[model samples]
Target: MTSIAPPRLPEPAPAGAAPPTSAPVLRMRGVTRVHGGGATQVVALRGLDLVVYPGELVAVMGPSGSGKSTLLTLAGGLDVATSGEVFVDGTALGRLSTKALAALRRRSLGYVFQDLNLVPALTAAENVALPRELDGVATRKAYREAVAALTEVGVAELADRFPDQMSGGQQQRVAIARALVGPRRLVLADEPTGALDSATSGEVMRVLRARCDAGAAGLLVTHEARHAGWADRVVFLRDGMVVDSTGEPSTPESLLDGDGGSTAGGAER
Candidate 1:
């Protein structure tokens, strides 16, 4: 009988490679976020510190309400921190004015949500081009970039289809293309594969991983060990705080075969 060997995991950093000299693409220092006030105050993140460098993908894993989504929102500039700082590409998010922050988000960041929020009325290409157009790029230029992005994510043929005309996986791919349309330095994904089947989910992970390898920084929020295996590192959060983080194992195949590591709050393993 012949035995197949398990696939080898990629090194966290290439063997004997020089350390990175550039600043992290995304950085969070002593970040915290609170909701409501007085009796209703709820802490979403508590003094979390994280950094994701170019060519790296970090997975944030925790139970529901463990602040995984909160971390992504703050990192993406969708929500402000109550205290502490978030920096993207060396610019402090807190220091940027509202307009400047909006501009920065449009030009430098990409966000993917579990809901796959493509506009129902717009075709896939138009939806992907909207951000570029809103950022003041010419319509032709934006649409050209949109087509290129869709092609990168393997969805170019569906560029003219409306949201309702595609399958869930296809819509999700379009959403990913929209996130990746511009010269984004950071990609923040919140359960990007939560709604897809196993095969489709794997495909999405491959796209995200490829983007990171191509010099973008990625922060992925996922509960599945298989998905987390795609990341270079896994951060575990509980009670709004990071309790553990570790490099991906040498044998990623083991992670999915029940040898996956644990996360904070006992939710992931």
Candidate 2:
């Protein structure tokens, strides 16, 4: 029997060129998320619009309670927006059923939490394979893919070790392997380097940068200017709104200086 081929998605524009006419891998339009009732309402995000394209890594920086994590959660489909819309790979998140949403997440989205949520019982390879297993891939195939991802993140030697057997940096590398495994089109990382030393943090950023360079769209939330420098564009969020973004006229140097250029709020922090 002849195997049927899957449908092909449009490719992203090349880096440093004009914006692509194709749809973005991730898109948020007038997104808002409010918590609690009238007496205790807190708006986590308000009328936010953003887009992350393939081969692009966008850094988000802001002070505490500035909706950085909220925006990430919304983009990853872990939380619903109070209004407006979020689309991942051209699929509107709000329109999908719970099951469909879960499936999409398992197959298309990868998230690396700050805490590095690796299971104690599972080895590194097994942990990385879990998502693919949940998505119905065969056990052997998942493990093979897991090994490949582990090698990509420079942790193949630790693939058989459990989480407790590794250092914090090693565990974080395993977590990144899990996130980048499979055909995930969007990778969302929340302070992925928060627990590592300076060298380890730089290594992780290099890995993330290489992943984006290889065609995945990345959204990273970080407070450190050094970390955000790895991103192609830095987005500053304040009180759930995009206060500024870095572009041609506003160099990363100016942004770091907290000058009156495109880098206004988060760049200084």
lDDT of 2 by residue, 221-255 (tens): 99999999988788889888878877421222333
Scanning candidate 1 in windows of ten residues, the lowest lDDT window is: 259-268
Clash pairs for candidate 1 = none
- Looking at model 2, the pairs that clash are none
TM-score of every prediction relative to native? 0.85, 0.85
Backbone steric clashes in candidate 1, count: 0
Stretches off by above 4 angstroms in model 2 are 1-21, 248-269
Report the C-alpha displacement of residue 132, candidate 2, in angstroms. 0.7
